[model samples]
Target: MSGTGDTAPGADAGELPAYAERVLSVAELIPAGRVMTYGDVAEYLAEEGQPEGLPAEGGGGRRVGGPRQVGRVMALYGGAVPWWRVVRADGRLLPGSELRALAHYRDEGTPLRAASQGSDDHIPKIDMRRARWDGRQDERDAPWDD
Candidate 1:
């Protein structure tokens, strides 16, 4: 991966953990100008299919695709995808790469909220209300949609 200068385990051999591949694919599916938080990505994957590294329900095993795990996947293998589209739940720009992310957000017409005048960095935040993508284009008949 081209991000953070540290390849994930097995990355040097052009391989990624199956979970990492799933996360990256979700990142790719996010439309330009829209975003998913790490939690959202994890939840989406969970609702859609059986995630890698996760045991089936009632198996009493640990799960591996929570928000933090999703974030780790992005940090390691995100550069090949639209990394900026995966954002924090609070809508704050990614630290250390705020400017770069801002450029991508602007280019994609993603909604943004201006920083308050008293802010130190004065960086705009993503407008989560407007920019968050839930991966649902229509109301599914699932009970959870209630």
Candidate 2:
């Protein structure tokens, strides 16, 4: 693939990694009570978007094209993945027919830094800048672990 989304050299389009699979890897990695942003995962996939230690190079750099793209995958097929980890850009939840998503978040101990401060009209957001996980690089890199 010469361009960003182009088929990698000698690689068939069908051989490319599925975006949902990438989404789920991190989803599964997130501890039961933690969460992440769609853009955060997008950043991880895009390299530039991830923070210091995300495995951005994974998925052969072929994760979903963007955050919105990731969101669409989750919307359609996130039933088994950690759907709650992905929140809106502003830290709000992505909507769906299952009213239980929010309730599930509440039950899993997904951090709610906003404390429902916004409004009655919106799902309470987590303030991405504050609550975003730093990924496990720091934990794995701790001097004691080695």
Candidate 3:
């Protein structure tokens, strides 16, 4: 595993750990105007690999890594996917890439909440209540059944 070269998108196969690849695959599946938390992405992959009827949060008996691991994968290989579509559980934009991500969110019409009253800037934050994607369904229920 140590010797594997870059496995990010556009790179050759086998460069990424199997789990990392699966993580990225799920990242790619997230649609525009929608977002999944790192934990959500992990759970989504877990559910997809496991049989139906598993617990929604843990994916019964499966071992999907936590949000930190999912974030690591995103840090290393998420450039090719809709990285912005994967966000924190709190719905705050990625720390350093907030503006860039905000652009995408705006372009995609992702739901957002105005900055808090005491905040210095007017930068809007994602409205997780409205924008979170569970990888199960969108508002239209067009994709991802189960």
Candidate 4:
């Protein structure tokens, strides 16, 4: 599959590889309050047809199981992805241009599982271990469970 041609909220359909598309889909599914890590996105993207077993770092030579790739993707072309749903591994909001992601979170009313003021310029990241969502509960499922 080359391109789905369906640009989602945080992704550019035609520009992304099929795997990135899949990751974007999963990210879109994340509820407003919950969040996912880059590693999660990479794994999900792999599941969606991204090549697996390849190293994720250093041009895919290093093992990448965390959220770096996903975060990088979102940082550049996350306009259509549910970017707010994909936070840094530390639970800190992903950096963005013009508070775009933050606006979505505030507008969507996503729960702030972590503390952040945005004034620090260097936001306090969230702890993914504690903030990463499994999408198990009803509320978690609502954002994309349909």
Best by TM-score: 1
Candidate models: Cα lDDT each? 0.76, 0.55, 0.72, 0.52
* Candidate 3 Cα outliers beyond 4 Å, as residue runs: 1-14, 48-61, 137-139, 142-146
Indicate which candidate wins on lDDT.
Answer: 1
lDDT per residue for candidate 3 within 47-144, as digits (tens), equals 54543433333434355588888898888777777888888888787877778889899999999999999987678899887777766534576332
What candidate 2 gets wrong by more than 4 Å, as runs, is 1-17, 48-59, 62-64, 96-99, 113-118, 137-146
Per-residue CA lDDT of model 1 for 20-121, tens digit only, reads 777887787788888999998888777735435433443422355799888888887787788999999999998888988999999999999999799899
Q: By lDDT, rank the candidates, best first.
A: 1, 3, 2, 4
Q: Write the per-residue lDDT of candidate 2 for residues 12-126, one digit (tens) a residue.
A: 3343345655665666566555556777767666654444333444435644468777776666555555666666767655544224556766787665654365576555665
Question: How well is each residue in 46-115 modelled by candidate 4, as lDDT tens digits?
Answer: 4423344422433432334346656555655665656667765555565443255556655765554444
RMSD each, Å: 5.4, 9.4, 6.4, 8.5
Off by over 4 Å in 1: 1-10, 49-63, 137-146
lDDT of 1: 0.76
Candidate 1 vs candidate 3, lDDT winner: 1
